[model samples]
Target: MKPGPVIRIDFRGGIVSPGDLYNILVAAGRLGLRRASFGLRQQMFLEVDDSIRNALCVELDALGIDYVNNLEGFPNIVSSFPAEEIFITRSWLSEGVYKDIFDAFDFRPRLKVNISDANQSFTPMLTGNINWVAAPGSPHYWHCFIRFPKTNIIYEAPVCAYTNDLASITACLEDQLMKGEMNGDALFGHPAMAHYLWKKAEAHLELPPFNLPYYEGLNRYGNKNWLGIYTREEWLSIDFLKSICRLCLETRIGQFCITPWKSIMIKSIEDADRPRWNALLDQFRINMRHAANELNFQVEDQNPDALALKIFLLKKLNRDDIRTFGICFGIKTRPRSEVFCNILIRRRAMIRLGRWSFWYRYDICCSEEFNPNKRTAWVFSRNNPRWLLPEQLRRAIIAYYDGKSIAASQQVEQSNRQPDKTAVQQIHQCGECLSVYDDPETSFGDLPAQYQCAVCDAPKDAFVPREWEKQSA
Candidate 1:
């Protein structure tokens, strides 16, 4: 969509108070905005009529609302709270823990951050510059990983950050990076965040492989119910939002969560209130159950071309019954913006067709070993036209399975060995840790000379082609 008079409201940690959201909705509804959207970072996206843009701004100001006009600067803190109860796991991480961490922040952060469960594939682990992942510890700990600004270099810190120190460490890191202290590996010893550090952090966090849960529709959670809402167009009606907010207020539901998937989850709906929720959905003709594949897409916020391309590719994939069960697709038309996906479609260059028309060529890449949490993306095909995406993406998927099969194969034989034709695939493994370069198609000679185990940071020569068996959904 074309940019107009726009304002973005940050809902820190994807957690929103019902009343706060309701008030904003009322303000927007009164100002002629019947539609809105949520961003991948869990912020609210609003477009005001150019003539009354300032008027909306005035109303927000009176209501003590803070908003920005563009995608640059002031990144929101992202957390896996949306998946907390729905994808519940036995861990020290709890709702109170999340709330405490949020409360510890004395000031808004200037950097993107992710506080996510290490075992959950529903939320990304490395999409932020400052990532505090759930780690094993008695006092509760988070493994801090930092991605340097304007660069692809992501590194591990020397110490794990205690829960109480997350805020101080975050603010300190932001301050230091602002002063051109871009060394991620050295940040642990910085005086600003030194004392807050605890035990030495593990060199790598072996995350669960990508497997997105079906996060839509009314679902049973204990005695209560949680309803997840998503719109294919992503343009949610203000009336719909307000209706849900009102229900939440009436039912005494304290809060709701907006996900990085650009959807909302309203939890703790009483069983008695189920009919009311169903009636509300019926009244608005909302369908919460979307096809599994339809729910796995991430488009650049409010990008028409990206959405269009998504629609086109989906049609082809569905028609062919393409299997994309374990993968997430991210479409990017904007340069240098982070996306959470196993398969990435990026706009490389545009070709002008007329004074007002143009066509874009794309580049395709996938995460290392098809692991969505890794920041590393290995290029497959580049400079592909729009029409070639479905085919190219299918081939990439095929490559993933082929590599997977090869990795499950037995160890290479002594002479001119090929991967064993067993049920498993065999790939390269690091001598120091469990990290493996699981791409069998890519020759060893073609691997980057400086490439090392992302987990152990062992030299490239430390990796040898090997076989292993692992099971996943």
Candidate 2:
């Protein structure tokens, strides 16, 4: 497969029974593994020796465990498992709802799929090819966003309702894309085709406002307590894992969730069981209360080198007392790595400066709103050394968000004194699609007379100026 001795086991929506994980750990131990790692997609990963690969595979199959060795044709379905009870959600998207939705999927999606609460930032909203966000207006409906495979272009689908409808729509879309029946760009152009698909998938549409809630540490939900555990070292010891699993089973906790931050979260701890859980933690010498700054980071799984770099950067930031509140960081070690963070520290291509030695550079980029979900455009600070990333990111985060807040406040204050007349500008926009042409750089002045939108390729004539702009003209 790709010259690796690793096996990946996906737990669908990051919801795994403690007993199942314990069994997997037992199997891994038999394969001479002492530790197991969790992926950003909430999948379990274990590094095994090549000599025992066959034996391990047979044993896993016998145990009815689903796994992949060095190939990821079907990516794991990601969800906001970390937000279940810890964060505020607009609607009741319970564990049962997640389970029902996951069980309905009969086919493995070729593209990444994400089911998340729009109100929570613990799970990325737009990183998936098919992003199903919980609609705030209704508990049964979801706002769907279709991000074209291998591209940043995203198209909003009609609000989807019913678990069966979600399954059918996902299957149909995957089939259409895989069989070359329709492409992402062409899907928006053909109204009849889009109408047929919508007709087949019936749902009412209601827009939802996006809100991100901070997720970390011990939190209370109802009367019970939930604990979030993070480790600087990515690997969780098998013994510690087993102990926790036993505790979960004894306490009657049904599930254990893995977050994209490579942390484990245990929810629904009984008030009486808190002392026992704390004692177990003391016995295992596990630390749950890591600093908030240290908790929000994304690194490539199974890469010790990247982990080392992250530790180094975090230490540097801590030493400097940099304020990273409400901000998350992502380190991109591999080429073209997709990250879900406000600030990104990307590794540039290695340069062959000489035969004996090579040089590398790092690029720093931050989202316009310092929000991963609103990653419309990245403000780049290119060609920097690896060591400069921490300071560069710190400065960029402050400059971008700070300036944006100031400008926003100024606009609001000015609007309070005078009417907002900027809407009178002759800007062209698409009603059917999420495409807008307001920026002077991308306005009609810069394009040919017959130019069309890059997303839906709608003709210039299709975009009509607003009534206010028409009156002003």
> lDDT (CA) for every model shown?
0.80, 0.71
Error of 1 at 348 (Å): 2.1
The C-alpha TM-scores of every prediction are 0.85, 0.81
Q: How accurate is candidate 2 locally (lDDT)?
A: 0.71
Q: Which lDDT tens digits does candidate 1 get at residues 33-145?
A: 98989999999989776787888888889889878876666888899988886785777788899999988987888888899877688878788989988884445788888
Residue range with the least summed lDDT across 10 consecutive positions in model 1: 410-419
Q: Which stretches of candidate 2 lie over 4 Å from their true place?
A: 1-4, 179-218, 350-357, 414-473
- Name the weakest run of 10 consecutive residues (lDDT summed) in model 2: 192-201
lDDT of 2 by residue, 222-321 (tens): 9999877777787788888888899999989989998877778899998888898788878978776677777777877777766777888889888988
The candidate maximizing lDDT is: 1
Candidate 1, which segments miss by more than 4 Å at Cα? 137-139, 350-357, 410-473
lDDT of 2 at 383: 59
